[model samples]
Target: MGLSSPTEIVATDKVEVAFKNLDAAILVGSMPRREGMERKDLLKANMAIFETQGTALEKYAKKAVKVLVVGNPANTNCLIAMKSAPSIPKENFSCLTRLDHNRARSQVAMRCNVPATHVKNVIIWGDHLSKQYPDVHHCKVNVSGGEVACFDAVKDEAWLKGDFITNKSWKIVEGLPIDDFSKAKMEATATELIDERDTAMEFLAKK
Candidate 1:
């Protein structure tokens, strides 16, 4: 999943080739990619892997529509991927902040005791980590037959940037109660249709 492997490379090729006919392709990775190798070496390890895969996408998946990095060191990994895929438009390379945004929306909605839809749109900006600014600004919603605004709850740009900086760090899930939780969750989630009625839609599309 990190770098080039026979099966992964083959699958990547198949996807790229298939998508070329459809006019676009997407590449996703599970871990963050970073800029440098460090003393602890963990960050560098993922970066190396991402760099290699990015190169592969650049070379073989030239026609891809978008490259979305959801992995840790997301921004760095995105940068690495984009760097590798010179053929792909840089604007097509984006890191996923939807999950973080979802968290923000859900939290606010629950706080207001409403479904997430009522919160309208929640934007998670910055690095996509805790430091990420879950700017609820510009968000609107219908609640209790009236409009309730909470975006202003976050205040301003400084608060958002400060929030992002304050929370940027490695994320690790623990106490899963089982060793297989990671893979199991991923497999299960990946298999589920994101849009129940539209099976062709991305399993995690925001829409």
Candidate 2:
């Protein structure tokens, strides 16, 4: 994957004066979740920070600048950022789905007893946090002899349907079968996103 620049600007509040005409903006700064903080709390805390950065991007960054939100609560934060920047095309915005992708990849790799590089095609569905679903049904691993379906390797039906860590890189993956359990998880993720969007709009209204 083509990685973004390491020149990170920690000063989210100073985006206006710090730079201009940016080609790609990797908004990685976020508040850490302290002891006993819920995911919703984390999401609410980062909303204002991303809102400011998104506004700055709209005013100063290039029209086609690709914005990647790498913080926790990334999906909701990305939504807030994208909504804040009306001029920037929505397709130009995204969140940290790579973590979900990599997490799924690692789990599959460990299951197959192969290096992570040997695993591919693990799909992360919906949000980037608790609501995310890592679908390995279509995944494959490069075993000693040859490649095999991830399910053939794991062979644990109950574990396959169990909870695991998550992203939504939906373009490269499509048309896969979704069982009832998977559907429920994906729907829950979507509902959570909708709630977050509504809350974000309300928060923005007060600003």
TM-score winner: 2
The list of candidate 2 runs beyond 4 A from truth reads: 1-13, 38-40, 163-174
**Prediction 1 TM-score vs. true:** 0.56
Where does model 1 exceed 4 Å of error? 1-26, 32-40, 151-207
lDDT tens digits by residue: candidate 2, 1-207: 122247643444356654377787788888878899975677678887888888888898889988888886787788888988999998898887787788788877776678999988877767655666777777888888688898887777666677444212323446778888778877888887888778777778878
Clash count (model 1, backbone only): 6
Collision count for each candidate, in order: 6, 0
| C-alpha lDDT of residue 56 in model 1 | 66
Using lDDT as the measure, which candidate wins?
2
